[model samples]
Target: MTSQARRKKVAWGITGAGHYLTESFDLFVQFKDTFGVEVSITTFVSRAAEEVARVYGLFHYLQTISPGDYMEEVILESAQGWSYPKTGRFSRGNYDALFISPTTSNTVAKIAYGIADSLITNAVAHAIKGGIPVFLVPVDIEGRIESPVPYFINRDICVGCERCQEACPHDAINEQIDYLKCTGCGLCKDICDYNAIQGGQVMLVVRDIDKQNVKRLRKMERITVLDDPSQLERALRNVLTEEAG
Candidate 1:
């Protein structure tokens, strides 16, 4: 009888940025079955990321991906206290590597400056200290980017019926979309008798400081900066290949 190879475990961190959230999640789902080798992903979501995931309708999706354990499979910053004890897994040699995809400019700055305040940031620090390779895809690496917005309302189409507002579970709708409160459940859009609510992509110009931060991250030790989220699969494959060699 032949024995099956042990699955490679990876730590994936998520931030508040919505640019590549969907794409990153899609890639995450494929990690378990698509990779040549068996791969197990443990997702670590920042507090703001939890909100963004909810707004994007991906919070539940993440839960579905890894339902085995709470902190073991899906670690949320909200549940972790000031110490972020779970990050110790990296120093204990638990994860093969760390991947922070669709990272926000704020997170990039924090990591570049060696700030370990948040759960994801602390994980990066431990991953580096433990000699584990870290890969990141900064959303603002380029000068400009077309990012997806979770929801929007066309006032012209809206009749001020307040039906959408009443239907909103998160109370994200009033006169306009209060992004901070919205979880992108799309319930308001679905309940609206008129077609006022909608969602689409938008173009954003990356600040010069953010671009510089990405440059700084590239020069950091044990960190690989990817051009875009699409390159994640290839970069990870190369890392695993090098490890096997």
Candidate 2:
């Protein structure tokens, strides 16, 4: 009821591993106060990351002001060497937009290749279908490249544990890097939890905010959750009711 949770709210969609969620939450804390601006984030996580998020304290903070709870949230379903989540809840038309942060190389690949077998990917495909704006921020992965500049791999850090490839939900992680399929979702790093993986150049950015920049928004003193179905429904019904009256 205080200013910490007041003002206009924007619907946010965060999907990936637990680490990205934590870093993103920390980033939001930096923008708690601003002029005529309030930002809020609500997210859904992979089943495995959910436990990590709980162990990492990310879960407690996220629940205090759930954008709409699991009823509106979802579990992602991955594939092959990785696990996936049930993703349709976030993809539904009610929410304003979607963002998959700390997007891993594999998640990026899924998006880049139009793989929609699971929830997040399916939703990503669907968001595009509706001409909705979708944002991605994959955690940096350390590896080789040949984008006319020969992106080299340290290999020294490569323990050959193969866990990253094992964690990919989209079957996109390959021994040899392929930029075309990598969408930068950051799942490998989040699942590692042991700091075993480093991301390649992933995708991330700020959108939906007004003239002001919102690289951070958790500490906002005035954030209003606008996606509440009741409120939206009421507002729409009022428009019709007023005309009838």
Candidate 3:
């Protein structure tokens, strides 16, 4: 009888940024499907990421993509407490590598400054302390990017009836959409009688401060900074190969 090769375990983290959320998830699915025999993945999703994923209509896909075959588990921040006890696994060397893709600027700054309040940031901290290689694909790494706007209100089409506001469960709809409060539930859009609610893509210019944060993260030890999410496959392949060797 022939024995199967050991699968490399990876910890994948997702933040709230919508810039490359879909792309990252697609790549993740591809990696697992293509390299299931050689690598296994466990996904860690932040609380904000859950909301953003719903907004983009990818939340269900994220949950089902890893059915305990190629992917091991999907850990959610909402399911964890303030201390995030699951993150202790990283410190225990439970994973071979940690990869965070479509990472938001907020997350990048927090990690660069050593803040570990959130689940994703806490995982990165513990992973680094445990000597696990950390790879991040920051959404705001480039000077400019075309990002998807999950929801928006058109003033010209809105009748000020406030129906959309009343239908919003998250209180995300006021004078405008407060993205932080929104979960992309589409309640406001559904209740809007004026057809003012809309969604599309928009061009965003990266801030100087965010670029500097990426620079700082790049200088951090044991960390690999990637400007594009597409580069993640190559990076992960290289790491797994090196580890196997």
TM of each candidate vs. truth: 0.90, 0.42, 0.82
Instruction: Look at candidate 1 and give me any clashing residue pairs.
Output: 55-183
Alpha-carbon RMSD, each predicted model: 2.5, 13.8, 3.7
Taking the tens digit of each residue's C-alpha lDDT, what string does model 3 give over 8-81? 88889999998999899888888877876677788899998988887776777665445655347788999999
The clash number for model 3 is 0
Off by over 4 Å in 2: 1-21, 28-41, 65-92, 141-245
**Arranged by lDDT, best first:** 3, 1, 2
Per-residue accuracy of model 2 over 1-245 as CA lDDT, tens digit each: 34554433223344445335555555433322231134343454544444445434355555543434433333333222243323333345434445555454445455555576545566566666654445555433323221111122236666666776787665556774343343345666666545655543433332233112122221122222222123332332222223111
Off by over 4 Å in 1: 1-4, 35-37, 70-72, 169-171, 178-181, 239-245
Using lDDT as the yardstick, the better of models 2 and 3 is 3
Predictions ranked by TM-score, top down? 1, 3, 2
Best by TM-score: 1
Q: Best by lDDT, which number? A: 3
